[model samples]
Target: MPIRFTQSCPTCGRRVQIRASLIGYTVACQHCNAEFVAEASIDDGSGTTDSPIGVEKIAVDPLMARVEEALQRAAKERTAVN
Candidate 1:
């Protein structure tokens, strides 16, 4: 069975076709440089398909944690240096 989905560009409202099987996968919008997941299923009467999965803010959490750790380390290093 072939999977079909719609992906909307974050930068642009342009919609693009994507494969449902590619869910949880990261894909870049051809029109815009925005990247997002190809999840969300949708049925447009013609057939069942997937929609453009919005970019989740999950990766930011880990990145923020790492930044905090680096800042703490830098503070400690500065204190020691002085």
Candidate 2:
């Protein structure tokens, strides 16, 4: 079976499964037809290059998260004050 990897289409924000063979090649989103380069998923500790790609878990930055929360509170406060 051909290995596949799922990545979100940047234009339409839909998950797209790309053939493993097409990695590093240009491919279009099946749903939106947006063209983009195919990227393999982050390694899952298997250390294998041919592993199937799936949803990647992105690590959240604590400082960035705090900043985002602060910004959101500021926005809400500004709206209330106005």
Candidate 3:
């Protein structure tokens, strides 16, 4: 499994997940579509990489999350088709 961590985009300042192995490589931000070198963020223990996304989990509705997952999957399929 690829180890992933969140890093804020330098352009839009939006948090984006970057593979730990991708550090020092060019990566594109999902939110801003800006390209920059990926870096591993130092965890302050406030949100450590040991946990999901380096943060304590926020309780999420299971059904809603499943629906959102389906929607995102469908969107990806649509994008691929185009």
Candidate 4:
């Protein structure tokens, strides 16, 4: 059996399982069609690479965003009143 390691898709945050042989090779995400490299280190599992991963898109809840904005507005108003 081939060894496999797990990583998240930079675009869609989907879980990806890569074969050990494919390390240092370029790969495309099946979920979002985003391209990235199958990078890994043999010494440790820190998952660090010289190249940085790009985030194409991220999903967020509208309600959470509204709540965050409201909190920011409230803080600004409070500061102005003080």
Report residue 11 deviation for candidate 1 (angstroms). 1.9
Off by over 4 Å in 1: 43-82
Q: Which sequence of candidate numbers ranks them by TM-score, best first?
A: 3, 2, 4, 1
Mark the regions of model 2 whose C-alpha exceeds 4 Å error after superposition: 43-82
> What are the per-residue Cα lDDT tens digits for candidate 1 across 1-82?
3445565666787887776556788988888768887666444668545453422322235665576578779999999999
Task: Give one digit per residue, the lDDT tens place, for model 2 in 43-71.
Answer: 55585334434322221456655655787
Alpha-carbon shift of residue 4 in model 3 (angstroms): 0.4
Poorest 10 consecutive residues of model 3 by lDDT? 50-59
TM-score of each: 0.44, 0.51, 0.52, 0.46
lDDT of 3 by residue, 17-78 (tens): 88765777899999989999876656677855332232112214566557657877999999
lDDT (Cα atoms) of all candidates against the true structure: 0.63, 0.70, 0.69, 0.62
Candidate 2's displacement at residue 44, Å, is 7.0
Candidate 4 lDDT (Cα, whole model)? 0.62
Which candidate leads the pack in TM-score?
3
Off by over 4 Å in 3: 45-82
Order of candidate numbers by lDDT, starting with the best: 2, 3, 1, 4
RMSD of each: 12.0, 12.2, 10.6, 15.6
Predicted structure 3, TM vs. truth: 0.52
lDDT of 1 at 42: 47
**Which ten residues in a row are the worst by lDDT in model 2?**
51-60
